[model samples]
Target: MTPPAALTLEFVSKHNVEGDLWIIVDSSVYDISKFATIHPGGLSVLLNGDIAGQDATKAFYGLHRSEILRRPQYARLKIGELVGRDEQQQNVPPDAIGSTSSIPYAEPTWLAPGYRSPYYKDSHRQFQLAVRQFVEDVIFPDAQRHEEDGKPPSQHVFDEMGRLNIIAMRLGPGKHLQGRALMRGIVKPEEFDHFHELIIAQELGRIHARGYSDGLGGGTCIGLPPILNFGKPVLRDKIVPDVLAGKKFISLAVTEAFAGSDVAGLKCHAKRVKDGWVVTGTYARLPESPKDRSVYVPLFSVFAARTDAGGLVVLVIPRSDGVQTKLIKTSYSTAAGTAYVTFDEVHVPYENTLGSDNGGLQVILSNFNHERWGLTCGAVSAQRTILEECLKWATQREVFGKPLASQAVVRSKLAQMIARVETSQNWLESITFQMVHMNYKEQASKLAGQIAFLKMFTSRNAQDTARDAVQLFGGRGITRSGMGKFIEHYHRTLLIDAVGGGAEDVLGDLGVRQALRMMPKNVRL
Candidate 1:
């Protein structure tokens, strides 16, 4: 047989260049068709990439630069030394309808083996480590600063994310990979019982409120991913390096004043203009709780809009400009400073448009899978904290004539919490495994629903376990010097169970839909 043809590069010439299929290398066209379907912004973005290819490469800053580098699963592609003009050639349109293939990818050489992980054999495991280190070291410390500044923690926390390479991990070294692959590689479920994940979350949760919030979603979870997922290369170049380095910050602005889970029903709109787009709408902020004596500050948010070329798309309009943020204080996430942000004709450049116009819904939804999984991880950790705290109390605190450990009722509750943690953590790992291996097209399928359900389940269980721990502590539990802080945190975590990726009812419905899809046709009820 003839030697296998070299994996030749396809390029777009003056004759045939689609709107999104080609990229400019130096001066000539370079076909990124292989990366088209796998693009985090969805296929439409790739089409637009073709149209904006030259300008995209030339962009120095803004959202467009950020999106280009945010591919969720891009760690798999090799970053080859781009050849000069001599190797450039015309792109050959494939007879195939869409995308090059449907498969998960592997890590690139840039993520060398020596980097430090026992679970490197599994991509999901590597991803989990990335998230853990990021939250513990960078995000948490920033939250502590927010506690002092009376402002939300986004600015400083995100600035550090850019430094640690955490933000870059999503789309950093490999450009050819897809989101599903990176997600799966980050954390595999079965690796730990649900309780194990909970144990980690609990340890992190022990930090002050700001620290915990930042570690969870205060920055990394809500900030970097979206920009990376749909923003153009111009946006990517400006934002990613900074956010990864902790120099900048960003956040998701999907939950509206009226709409919570019904993303498709958003009322926000972006009117098109000659140079760019203008977004106008209101975002709600949480009201502060009296129980929380700590000082609280608020933040404005960017909003999502639908444009002529792209449907349901999002933009990052800062609090300083035409945008306004109203703080809606709540009992939870005191460190986060929840708020409702309203936009009034916020101008966004043509290049600032993230992903394809009207593709915002898909862009936002596609990213939820990871967000949900992360919440589950955090929730599990919260439960572990409850167990650890209860254990400490049981061994020391006297009950009646004996230590609480001798009480059957207390032991029952502690054991139950541990059991629940185990169940949730194991499920989390299993789901993580499936995520790493999941095909591109199937990313939003039944498995996505599983992630949602796990998030709901884990969050609820974590809340309940925390409550039980406080109850078990009896008198000491209610005091600030005793379990007071833990009890305060317990209530705070309950709110998280319903928000980050989705609410319980929403995830339940999604799980139902997924279950229905998995049934055989003849088995209809």
Candidate 2:
């Protein structure tokens, strides 16, 4: 490295109208012209010479300096150290630059009866308002005491969430609530970015900042869909209603220490008994805050195991005498509680077997399509929050006699963040629209690829946005106090991308497999 460059700029000062000019900053060259119009931040940085170049170094310091060099666009560069270089004096990658052309936004138009006004409109808005008021009046105050003691938010807060019908958003109409898992696809599609589903994702993201958002949306995915889709009518009638009524909270506990993405490899096992089944396994818990001391006992555990018939099965086991829970400390505290569960010969009645004896794999697969999508929503929302936070900090934070937002470099960073969010959001919504209305059952092969693609993109985007938000916050971002808690939540939640439904690599492989299925027989993988 040559004493580290002061700054580097890559862009054509003058070029043919159709040509792209690559500009090199630090060790990497960026195809500024190609990025010009396509830049989500805007065209200003691209059109203006060296926006992120040498002269921009005044705003540079810690991670930003290293981050700029790590952009995928610069991976092929051979240079080291910036050492204050002029625009015309650097090397630009030849093929890296492309022709100047317009890039179209990928969002699709939302169509009718499905695109009806939001479910949270009119009376629903009042409900949301009342719920928020409750959070402020009762929950927030109680949460403060827990916060002071370094404990997770109070259980009263969660109970309040249940009382507000937040937990019942999917079951049926409660307090005039009519949104179902299916209808939510419609209402959420309208709110999503060009990607369509990203909008509903944002809503979940907001609720997540406060406390346990998993049981609500996550339950709707794995919990309701499975039993409703596969369980016997008696099981549906007996279990589904309470799950919908907020009387019970459902969570899928398939991920184990050794089997993260390998669902089929889960070690949990069940043995057949005269009446039903005996299940035994250890399920890991994320962690809990110690102050409030209100224990969260997981009443429902979705256990994946190989049945005596030599086929995979999912047993829905409710907490009973045989089931035991142990609290575990974890990285995130917003989630009031998490526990390691042990089922020592826990007996689940035959009626509780969610799907056919050997068809548990299908149930698990079906549940993922929606669960991954919910994560997509949360991930995108995380980006949206990062954007808002960055803008606020830029405009409000003063440095060296001027607000940080006044600097061209800072503005450029902000713009890049905005562009990234928009692009990801658009992709999210598009996939959501396809999922909600496209009837994937008839085209399982075709739908699989799209879902996997969206999952991978959205999760990565959320992680990236969280990282950027922390950077924008600087020292305050790393702290556990004040607004820092939000940043901490975002930081710890990175696992959400990889854990929830499937790993990024797993999704990518499934996407490729789906794409392969669409190919002609001769070319199939």
Q: Pick the lDDT winner.
A: 2
- What's the true lDDT of residue 72 in model 2? 70
Number of backbone collisions per candidate? 80, 21
Model 1 error, position 416 (Å): 0.9
List ranges where model 1 is wrong by over 4 Å: 1-162, 167-212, 215-217, 285-302, 306-311, 318-320
Model 2 lDDT tens row, 58-162: 222212323345457744433343445557545343312111112121111221123343322443333333434444455545654553344545555555545
Model 1 score (lDDT): 0.54
Task: Tell me the deviation in Å of residue 347 in model 1.
Answer: 1.3
Model 1: residue 117 alpha-carbon error in angstroms: 14
- TM-scores, all candidates, are 0.64, 0.65
Summarize candidate 1's per-residue lDDT along 34-62 as a digit string, tens digits: 66667556666545534433423332121
For candidate 2, which ten residues in a row score worst on lDDT? 97-106
- Total backbone collisions, model 1: 80
Q: What is the C-alpha local distance difference test score of candidate 2? A: 0.56
Angstrom error at residue 383, model 1: 1.4
